[model samples]
Target: MSIQDTVDEMAPLRPENRHGTDPLMVLNGIRQEFPSSRGRTVHALDGVTLTVERGETLGIVGESGCGKSTLARAALLLRRPTSGEVFFDGKDALSMRGGALRSHRKRAQMVFQDPNDSLDPRYRVQRSVAEPLRAAGVSRADAAERAMAALAQVGVPEDAAWRHPHEFSGGQRQRIAIARAIATEPELVVLDEPTSALDVSIQAQILNLLLELQERQQLTYMFISHNLAVIRHLSHRVAVMYLGRIVEVGPAADVLANPLHPYTTALISAVPEPEATKRERIVLTGDLPSPASRPTGCAFASRCWLATEQCRTEAPPLTTTAMSEPGSGHLVACHRPAEAQEALASGLQLTA
Candidate 1:
């Protein structure tokens, strides 16, 4: 069957694939390795397994070098993973090439971290927005009509569409970028820090715009960022990464309010809270281990204060705990779940 046929056969809005329906996208055992100097291989993404359900935002949060960006690229098939599976809309994405890949690309789009990186200085905003459609064989006149509509949806006026990207502010550039992403009416949009480059107030506007767009189109999103607060705002589900592995994942409210993984707790602790919502800070002492020479067991074991000898010797598999959150079950890969929870229960005074 054709890729479009496969898409047509499936029903949408099924969460966690409970009803035997396929989600928008699924990544299994995705690994991206880069050859470093001195014959060392840097494991950018090490066995990442994730899913983005239809019409829901799955936020990926991690520190720099935790393979968040690499994950995004791998998932989008922009850069194929060193080894793994990428299934989009129930079709084998990694297997697609030529026309199949091209057809599938229409259903999935990406909005990058910096609009400057995506927009061309030479092209006007209208051409930039219409480029994807033109590539898909849409006539110039039709592409322009769709592009104008998309720009209007993102609050970019018809007048601004004729101007160059340099003529717009940073925030406006991002809106144009978003317009280009949705012009094809993609089912999934991988937003890789789409608002990180903008000012704080502008950040809120961009986020609100994204939410509005998603609602209007029933779009799925794989939103990646290091900012937990922003993730909390835009995500329906959250995945926390440490050293190229998912340490924890669940509904946004449950995972943030009651994190089961030590790494997630440390991340949440770092977020400044008001006096009434003050949390016990758990200071992680050691620097993040180099991905080129990762630890033998749990990636975060060295810096995890609650880690035991077992955590050092054996890597923990991501498993569903008794502490699963509502709507979505929580998955955590920590050997010492009880101790990790205890550390937060008691006023965590000691440093890792």
Candidate 2:
């Protein structure tokens, strides 16, 4: 069957698939690809599998074009996957129709980056936040009331609600974006680099605000970013993506402290430390390979220091290694797992 047919078959709002013990959101072998000329395809996401526990923050970090946003869109069901399944609260996430889909919409919302563009410039903050509720059948007066509450929840002053988006600073505008996202009291909010465009100080404020809101509202998050330090602070677990595939995933502390994949290690090493005396950077060679024609064995093999002949000929599946698993699961895709570990320990400086 075609990808669209597969999507149509999965029922995202069924009760049977919604009662998992741990996960509130699950992505099973999800894949997304865009067709290219010459009978090729750009593999944006390849067989990604992960889960989000209720009220947990899961950070997804990767280089640009590694499908971070695409993954987020898949979870939101905004961008249908080319293959695989999404289970939310035990139901197929791709099959809901009409009211079911509409109800589910309130359950999952997205906080986009760039408040300036995300919020309609012409719409006042009150109307912008009220838009979702209005769409869900809320009365105009009631929607306005809910919009004000949402604004307060995100730290916006009451007076600002009547003002246009341009009336506020970038940080306040982002808070407005957050208000719109939470107006419906969504259980899961896919945060797509919500703070990346803000100033450093503002980023911290937004992060703290998100954490506070999550705790207060018991919200689950799929936080996507390229910033390791931000991920370390916000995530309960971290999944590292490279070339559209997750090469390493585990508890945030464990994966950040001892990254398993070569790409992950290189990424972690690039994070600047406060103590200059203790810092040693690992610079990988070459630019990120294009997704249209990925490497045969490992997508990361071209830039991987420990890659061998086997790595070039056989693809590695996401699997557990013998080193030691973190409390939450930590998985890696590499033929020479030990060698990857040795490279991490030796602080091997990658060469071109």
Candidate 3:
């Protein structure tokens, strides 16, 4: 059967839908490597394993070149992984054949970082939004109707839909991009810094729009962003990535309030605070190591002040930490998390 047919058949199944039973989307030991000169490989994603539950928003946060975007592309099977599996709705996503894969593409959609780049200048907002519906085999009449509705849903006016992308503002173009992404009512949406290109005020509007849409349509999101503040607002759980591996994964509240991992603490510290007295800035030292020549142990080890001899010699696997709970589990790939927390409490200046 076609993936769309399969999705239609299984989408009605509520009994099979439970976060604990299995993830709606799963990444198992996935890796993406690019060939470099002199027999070296660029490890964009090094064995990343993640899970997104049904109707849940999972935030992925990391520095640039930390492989979070690559992971998102891998999840959508847009960037083929060098190793491992991508499971979508309990099916082997990577192994999907021909039309099944095409159908899967319809079910999974992406909202890119830049609005200007995503939308075609020549195409009107209505045409851009209707593009997906047309590919989905909807009639031109039905697609046009749906496209206008989508534009309205994303806070664009019915009149704006008739205009070209170049005629609209950045925020408006982004809204149009969002409308196109949700035009087909995708089950999974990968938002890669969807609001980063907009103004601070406009970012909130877009975030609110996304939340409203998710609630209205019961959509699942793999929100990829570097902004912790944005992630905290939109995500139920947050996964912190470094180099190519997940350093920390847990409930947003726990991870933000009491970050166990040193890297997580450093990331959270960088978030700007309104109050001066309460804010403690963590200025990390040096530059992030290149993915092609990652450290032998933890990828964060070179920058991590808490790194011990063991940390340099042995790679820390993401094991179930003590913070794992019923609904939300906190996992940290660090052996010295407790020590790092203690150092933070002692007012130690954390250098990268």
Candidate 4:
């Protein structure tokens, strides 16, 4: 069957399918832009809308400068989008002020990409970890006690709590950072490339630690990374971004195993595969278009081998697609999704 025929056979994803119980975070029509000195606006994020279900990890993956970090910041309310509604646990977070906003911010925490950059070298580990607690009005003694326990939970030695961030190695520092992030017992955590700065072995350790913490604390995560393997391992759902928009989103395993979007297929094809089961790679052409001067049509049309005249003239909406697994939600934005799906099914090599 043709891809469009296949898509037609599937039911559209319902709103309930995209959410569970009460989602921990929701971004509705988020659009972030910055005015350049040249008087043109740089579109950092364009109409990003997604939800992070409580206790599930939603991974955002894309090339650098694809607005992954911008989305993260906007979700955390660190950088309020130029236009959008942010909701936390059904509350309109974008409308909160003063103490209400501070309280909401405490419920969500962030673990940055670099521990060295995130940690204060001069502060002792306990103080660093206790900062959030202190900010939340916890007494110094209680905060210290919680800090020690948090440090211990992440496998940092209790004795090390008295030492500065400079005393620990990169991995240990990240552990400290993780300890600090969770010290306040946040319901949601936004991890921005948390493992990218570490070595391979250390990356595994950190990932495992995060998994452990999630199980123990029922933490919801917005895990952002460019590493497909990492996303596959850690995410319940994955969102694929390009330029300033999410092009594909679905259950992580489904999207990784049967990518329906050309951009997604090209990305997955680049991952290292076992020689015995390797398929031809999809090599894309052309540099990424500047966000300051986005194309009138699909942002990825310039590099898509399957792109047609329609792709060059009109942007595709994020449309729902049939998933192999029942009750799974898969959405892709492409003018030629059917062609891209056929190419993958036929194991046809795509190059541009």
Q: Candidates' lDDT values, in order?
A: 0.85, 0.84, 0.83, 0.86
The lDDT leader among the candidates is: 4
User: Model 1's lDDT to the true fold?
Assistant: 0.85
Q: Indicate the worst ten consecutive residues by lDDT in candidate 3.
A: 10-19
lDDT by residue for model 2 (1-27), tens: 232343244323222213233798889
The sequence of per-residue lDDT tens digits that candidate 1 reaches over residues 1-352 is: 2323432443223445332235788899999999999999999999999877788888999999899999999998899999999998788999998888887888899999999989999999999999988877789999999999999999987899899999999999999999999999899999999988999999999999998998899888999999998998888788998888899987776577667898887887777755536545788886889999999989998888877799898999998877664435678998877667666556566576
Task: Write down the TM-score for model 1.
Answer: 0.92
In model 4, the runs with Cα more than 4 Å from the true position are: 1-21, 274-279, 322-327
Residue lDDT tens for model 3, 1-352: 2223422433312333323455789899999999998999999999998888788788899999999999988899888899999989989999998878877888889999998998989998899999988987889999999998888888887899889999888888998999999988899999999999999999988999999999999999999999998998888778999999998887666666667788888887777766535645677887789999988988888888878899998999886665444444678899787865655565546555
Q: Estimate each model's TM-score.
A: 0.92, 0.91, 0.91, 0.92
Clash pairs, candidate 3, are: 285-352, 303-352
Q: Which ten residues in a row have the lowest lDDT in candidate 1?
A: 3-12
Give residue 47's error in model 4 in angstroms: 0.6
lDDT of model 1 at position 205: 96
TM-score of 2: 0.91
Q: Lowest summed-lDDT stretch of 10 residues in model 4?
A: 6-15
How does model 2 fare in lDDT? 0.84
Candidate 1 RMSD to the real structure: 7.4
Ranking by lDDT: 4, 1, 2, 3
Q: State residue 297's C-alpha deviation in candidate 3, in Å.
A: 0.8
